[model samples]
Target chain A: MIDYDALLNTASTMGLRMLESGAEAYRVEDSLQRLCRAYGADSCEIFAIPSLLIVSLCDPEGHSHTRVRRLYRRGTNLWQVDQLNSLCRAVCQGTPPFPEVDGSLARLAEAKGYSPLLQLAGFAFVAAFFTLLFKGTAADALCSLVAGAVIFFAKYPMERHRANSFFVNGACSFLAALTAIAGVRLGVGQNLDKIIIGAFMGLVPGVAITNFMRDVLEGDLFAGITKLTESLLTATALALGAGIALSLLGGAA
Target chain B: MMEIFTGLLLPCFYAVMACVAFCLVLNHHGKLMVVSSLGGGVGWAACLLCAFTGSDIVQYFAGAVAVAAYAEVMARLMKAPATGFLVVGILPFVPGGGIYYTMEYCLSGDTELFLTTGIHTFGVAGAVAVGILLVSSITRLLREGRAPKNRHLGGEK
Candidate 1:
């Protein structure tokens, strides 16, 4: 007597998790279908978009179920994808009872992030090293570090309030630009161009752009175009934020 | 000779460190971070190779091919999403700097520099896409013949 509710829950939840963790739409569809099959379900079908996921499963006994989830927050956390990947392995070995699957997902959903301090440092190092890669001087890396810290730490409070993506990124890039320009104005870095470019790395649409590329190539044309436009706008917001500072600074000096 | 060696070595080193940091920021754990760093290093190494000898287009395409191929291999070995590796692995060639420089020129009203760099930037971006497409297409081809059905690259079945 396969518990259809449990099956539906697990299948849809896994799809949702994959979608939220920045997977391509086709991958999301494929994983959900496979997971359902592994669970003794006859079929699972998924229609995944950047903003919504719809899944339908038919159990071996010919029972059918459907779930539609409207996604509110889409983020990129590869860790979640890795966790789900392992969970699938466990299920295939012996279809875990629903509770075990449920427990693993709960833990995964609530997995603790690395400390704020460490992530802030990670941001700083990313900016600094990339500056060095771009042939910026040591002083430019130092300036990038400072600017990175400003942008990275500033994101916490902005996210706490659950602000809009464009506004949050726009505002943070604004801060990033101001900090880098100030560093240059104070003789902390030699090249404003290099420093600002390095500082902007943290805000670049890495996940979006990568996923969009994968999506387009994977034949998810609609999803690919959607993500492509979004990534482009995100890049635009970043440039806009930094542009304001540059424009103002240029006007001043 | 020494200058060329250092020129290549330093960028690769920074790329490795930067990829690790990028992974850490995205919350990748233990072995995944190391593997991703190696992948990024390979991609950056390819980029440097392109810079030294190849045309602008092929170099960009080659770097992307390196990234996509490495990410595909690593994902198969690790049972993780190739996207995880692809996202960070391709960072070395991402057009962040191009975007910034384009905007800078636009703002400064330097139409000449803006158009030239903008076209180049767009070309590099396309080259990266072609790289990912070529490798992913290969992976899909390899996965399609055997492997039962529809289970390739992170399906984990």
Candidate 2:
């Protein structure tokens, strides 16, 4: 017989995964409720935000099991979110055994991210294309491609060390801005604004802003406010990074 | 020289490339990446069309609504969370440029440009929020309206 604690753990695990994978708070709550109901729990309650998730389950006997997880890191991984979405759908359809759901959740968490080389290439293309989209000349795109590669390489080490988001974003943007400025100074690119805007694409917190709006629209007011503040912080870090470099460049010239 | 063809096509191509790349960065892969690219392309095309009118806020609001509406429909058809597409679709006009320019002006001590850019940046950001909220409310209403019908149809069994 599967222990009640084990089943609650499984349900809460699913909720935690959804939360960490950037699902909205209400979605996480709904998934937890469904998973618990499918598995025979009388009641389930979940409070999920970007930073922390609280889940509790109650049996008919009035005994309850609760779990709290602190999400020290939060970022989008649509692949994980997609898989969890499928898992919850399955759970809602049938009460899969705890072990099966556990295996799936583990697999989802262990899913591989894009390779570093591919990520670098992706960053380069994103920066270059953003320059083109901004109406920069081909020369500007070429310059941004190189700067993007540098920023990607710099970002890898910081992320590897699990650095803070603000510091990582600030440093990455500074490196990108400085690289673009240096290139323009060398006559390799024209217009610092285009270059700065181009390389700034990746660090812009697009996902945060998008998720923030979605959360608010979904009536997850606390989650919305928290994510909005977080987005603002990220934008500030990005700007500070680029601004510092531009001012330094100005001073030196 | 209007160069209408290049002007029309370049942003779409760039939007597609940037969307795919940003998806990779966000760890979104598989066929949905292509869907995201298409969504991004169309949303960007809409924004670019509005941009010709020289109204930044309008384009952003319209672009965001277009993107969110697309994401909502696609999510229903694909049985996927709207986020997987919404996050990438509006990449072309997410105010990254405005934020950068605002900061640059601030740091360089250009008070006039800084204020203008800063206000414009916040305005565009609000426009995006407004657009998404508008579409999301509609989708929510649609879903809630359908729930009763599904229950009446005895699908709950």
Candidate 3:
């Protein structure tokens, strides 16, 4: 006897995890439907947006079960998304037992990624090299490197508290701008524009913009629009923050 | 040779390094990280290679197309979703500085510069989107046409 409720729950959980880890809406919906079909559902209906997922399937006995999951936090952890994606494919292919599937999901949720130190190095590397790529002097890259570290340290704590993303982005850019300005004033960096741009690149909405286009092209207009608004708002927040810093310092370059 | 080295190879190197570091920030590891960062280099090179067009939008479009095609091929070979490669690979063309400058112009009351910069920024974004969409749609169509069968219709007991 197949447990319909558990099946719906498992499938919905998989979709929820994918969405929370920044999977595209259509991919989440497809994965949910596939998981259900793999578990003996005649057919399944799955609807997924950025923050919500709903999956419903009718058991062989004609009783329908539906599972709805609301995602509270969303971040780009491609590792998690990739792992969950592989897990979904494997389960669909082999029709794994329920316990094994549940165990894998639980383990993945607790999996650790890069260490904080390595991630900090990542932030610094991107900021420094991007400064160079944008024609900034070597000193400017060094300044942005420090500013990048500041943004990371400032943003990390807020992220842990689940603060509003807009506020976090704004604060990070504000801090980065101020740091860049100070670096220039102290003669440690040249070209304020280059340093500011490089420092804030870490906070830019590359993923959001990419997803906005992809979701739109994939016919998930609602999700696409949501991401477009998200990227736009993030850009606004960054500009507003940096503008405030520049105006306060009387250095509008 | 010096012009080619400075114009092409150096920038591509910077893009690839930045993308590799970015992969760390996104917590992507292993061979996928190395492969995806190469896509970034490919994108930047394509963008530079199209400089003769004298239009940023067309250059970005070409770069995005190259990245999307690279991502599709890598996704197939690696058995991973293309999103990983696509997202990381396209970063070099995302126009972060443009967004900053546009906002600065708007804030400083330079309405004319703001308008032009803002429009250009959106144009670059739209070009990239269209490029990715074209490649993805064509690939999907080709794959579906080739298969034309539902391989996982029912549960395997």
- Which candidate, 1 or 3, would have the higher lDDT against the true structure? 3
Q: Give the least accurate 10-residue stretch of model 1 chain B, judged by summed lDDT.
A: B148-157
Q: All models: lDDT?
A: 0.82, 0.83, 0.87
Those runs of model 2 whose alpha carbons end farther than 4 Å from true positions after fitting are A1-3, A251-253, B146-157
Number of the top-ranking candidate, with lDDT as the measure: 3
lDDT of 3 by residue, A24-108 (tens): 9978877777787787786677788897888988767778788788888899989988999999999999998888898899999
Best prediction by DockQ: 1
* Candidate 2 per-residue C-alpha lDDT over A73-147 given as tens digits, one digit per residue, 9 for 90 to 100: 777788888889988888778876778889989988898889999999888888999999888999999989988
DockQ of candidate 1 (2 decimals) = 0.53
Sort every candidate by lDDT, greatest first: 3, 2, 1
Clashing pairs in 3: none
Per-residue alpha-carbon lDDT of candidate 3 for residues B61-115, written as tens digits (9 for 90 to 100): 9999999999999999999989999999988888888888898888789999999
**Candidate 3 DockQ category?**
acceptable
Best by TM-score: 3
lDDT per residue as tens, model 1, B1-157: 8886678877889988988888767887789878988788899889878775657778878989999999999999988888888988888788888888888888999999999888887888888888998899889878876543654444232
